[model samples]
Target: MNFALGRYFPADFPLHRLDPRAKLLGSLLIMVGVLGARDLPALGLLALGLVATAALGRLPLSLVLGGLRPFFWLFLLTFLLNAYFTPGSPGPLGTSLEGTSQGAVLTTRLALMVLTASLLTLTTSPIDLTDGIERLLKPLRKVKVPAHEVAMMMVIALRFLPLLAEEAERIKKAQMARGVDFEGGILKRLKNMVPILVPLFMSAFRKADLLSLAMEARCYRGGEGRTSFSELRFGLGDGLALATSGLLALVGTIW
Candidate 1:
């Protein structure tokens, strides 16, 4: 449950109360804007807006920053690769100035996207997300899409993500206790992980079997004529969110 991305933090803020559909739409717009931003200035503005939105959601600064910890090395590697390898005019530091600039911009764009997406999951519950996705994909059913089943599978995957993380942590600790050297060379570390991964896979399979059996026992069926316990309603806040998202998208496009 301590894993950052899929964990939802309950709060009484406006973002938490927004209809999932509105939040999903806004998130899509922001993602598009971030992906298309052509310069650092545009990214900076989008980052500022995301930070403000997180503040409005009452999310702690620590939570926002911590969400990107797992990707720190990935970001660094991307920056180094782009900075040194990209063909451009050489800078005083022996790296191409254009490459360095592009690397920095790319890194910032990815980091901002991760932080912004964290806000969506932090404020929205898995159930609400599932429902919203099902509703959105309902139109696809005309093409024989199993919208409900697809949504259910997505929700189940999200629910299991944290469980797997926790299990990995526990397995790591147990291996470390038994003198496994997990911090040596890359190959050595990978060899050390064999013991952990084998057991983890076995455990995952066992859990899957049990879940299947439990669902069968309960006579669980796919979504058909399903009724929701919570009704989704669009309000003024949703309208504002959509308008703001559209504005951000426009600015990013023009920048």
Candidate 2:
């Protein structure tokens, strides 16, 4: 399946209509709540909130869950490390009960964080996201932060995700056609991936080089005098979204 993490699914929904600034800040607040969650109940509440948001946005359940696919191994590794290393009462298979609990909680937190970010990208276009970020960071100019540059870099990175995923998929298929076996023991699979990874890196670099050339050709300067075509305005929807996110953050942190 195609990677869906950073790809926006256009839809006329409440979330898609909100200002990107609100969505960005709301996602941050939800992340804070995810981090502050100390127990399963808090985690469950946050999870429910995410599901509700997804539902409100009319996002497909499959697409939302698919965003988690890329991190499956990371989640597994995190759980295993915590379960095996954390000191606690003894439990099944030489794992501690506390360790297992901690592992579960930590994994859940990680998943929640990823889902929050996925929702943000799914709802907001890259252009709006960049504008929102730059505007939000404008205050930091007092401290000499390159807000526009930073926002541009961030959005560029996000925009590259789907491109890279597609490139990797193409390379994998080509290798498979050449009888390259990706299915094997862990070590063998790792060794087999070299062919795909090497080509993928080269393709990525080439794409980056082309992008730079295209920018230079257009006489592109920094965001110093940049003007946006669509000015973002905070409306009632933005306020309500921020308020709800703030409430959730408070509950997660305090409860």
Candidate 3:
């Protein structure tokens, strides 16, 4: 129910204090660099960077690992599918290898991607992150894609995440009080979730309704020339961060 899907990193770290523009840009460079990586060693390097950055953010190792929980099966499935299905060389070179290498490559790639993404959320606060993102995408306005509006929508979504989490937590406590143990086995837990999910969803809809009304009352229009309270600026620290990430990208590309 912790809807804060973003900001995996706790605040107070030096990285956490950097401008959102720097963080967003650095995160993009890392993601693009890692995802573009074709070789295993380069991918491994990307993973290492993610770990180091996460440590820099001062997040708990357990929290980092926990994010990988749901993806365990995904990793496994990716590996299995790739290993068995990635058309391979026949004869002695092929060695009839099925899921081993392909699976490993796929899983490794996915893990690195996830780690990189998680690092972004861990370090950046929700509001500033979205604001930076919107500002970054502002250039896309020429195409009439409504970049600002989209950004506002994303901001709203991120803002509600923690609130929704609290609501979910409340629902969970209420269910638990009724002897609905959500800690049971899979099916049992799923069955128990019905009570919590139903009410939580209803509450979310209600909240959404109220939010719509609130926005309407405030005369909120689309993000047309909407100025931000905290303007994003790139400082020396931001430059250093960007340079570091770019250097990493360079290394990744050549390696």
Ranking by TM-score: 2, 1, 3
Q: Which ten-residue region of model 2 has the weakest summed lDDT?
A: 1-10
Candidate 3: stretches off by over 4 Å? 1-4, 7-10, 87-98, 156-207, 213-219
Candidate 1 residues 1-255, lDDT tens each? Answer: 246677788888888999888988898999899989999999988988898898999998888888788778889988888899999998866789999999999999889878776788889998898888898899999999999899888877766666777888898899889988889787898788898899889878887889889978988788877889888888998999988987997798679
Among all windows of 10 consecutive residues in model 1, the one with the lowest summed lDDT is 1-10
Error of 3 at 63 (Å): 1.6
Q: How far out, in Å, is residue 225 in model 1?
A: 1.9
Model 2 clash number: 0
Every model's TM-score: 0.91, 0.96, 0.75
Worst 10 residues of 3 by lDDT: 90-99
Misplaced by over 4 Å in model 1 are 92-94
lDDT per residue for candidate 3 within 115-175, as digits (tens), equals 6666667777777777888878878878877876787787677566657777888888988
Q: lDDT for model 2, on a 0 to 1 scale?
A: 0.92
Off by over 4 Å in 2: none
C-alpha RMSD for every candidate: 2.0, 1.3, 4.5
User: Could you tally the backbone clashes for each prediction?
Assistant: 0, 0, 8
